[model samples]
Target: MSESTGGTGEGTRAVRAGLPEPVKNEPTLPGPVFAAHFHLPGDVEGPYTYGRDENPTWTLLERAVSELEAPGRDDVQTL
Candidate 1:
């Protein structure tokens, strides 16, 4: 239960859970990214190189799930 959703109804909490803060020119929920490979310059030292290995979509999902499961705890990690 996030601080925002604390003491709120389950439906409300579920709907509000894991939502990112509002940005000026961004959607409330980002669209999915579907790329098998990313462009890497020089050595492969960037965050994403292989889709199967890591993805921004999954990262956001994990964060959301973690927040739902363990709110206010940065030590929690979801997969």
Candidate 2:
């Protein structure tokens, strides 16, 4: 067990750092409002075939959290 945030070096990083800012998706401090889906051009297929598949906000949060957990997050599983 680490005297700091867990013995894992990755865990230490997670504890010290925060999330990454949204790059292309960035909004004002207000941030991008939630959109269930983006309209695709005719026959464009899709950026997201379905809303259930993925969302921008979800991705932002996931990326941020992923970094915090870093090496520790090798194989995250949700039961």
Candidate 3:
């Protein structure tokens, strides 16, 4: 077990990290999005153009790691 911080245990924090706020009909934890390619009309104007480059699953994992490592600091960047 790891140390606790901000009155929350490491295990607890890890479990709750990166979780978005509750929605009326949305699941508490969203399922992973698996895709090799996304629709691109003309040019790649959006963040997610390729699966290997970027995806919702990676974004969520990054958020979770960032939260666990830096808590309330939004300036923290996770790779």
Worst 10 residues of 1 by lDDT: 1-10
Local distance difference test values of all predictions, in order: 0.70, 0.51, 0.78
Which model scores highest in lDDT? 3
Candidate 1 global lDDT: 0.70
lDDT per residue for candidate 3 within 1-79, as digits (tens), equals: 7667667778888887887866988788888665677574687576676667678878788889999888888778889
Sequence-dependent TM-score of model 3: 0.68
Q: What RMSD, rounded to one decimal, does every model reach? A: 3.8, 6.6, 3.2
Model 1 lDDT tens row, 7-76: 6665665666676866998887777776677564675676666567677877777777887788678689
Better of 1 and 3 by lDDT: 3
List, in order, the clash count of every candidate structure: 0, 1, 0
Sort the predicted structures by TM-score, highest score first.
3, 1, 2
Candidate achieving higher lDDT, 1 or 2: 1
lDDT tens per residue, model 2, 1-79: 3443445465555543334433685752335645554564675564544466576556545655665555445354221
Better of 2 and 3 by lDDT: 3
Ranking by lDDT: 3, 1, 2
**Native-referenced Cα lDDT, model 3:** 0.78
TM-score of each: 0.63, 0.38, 0.68
User: Judged by TM-score, which candidate is best?
Assistant: 3
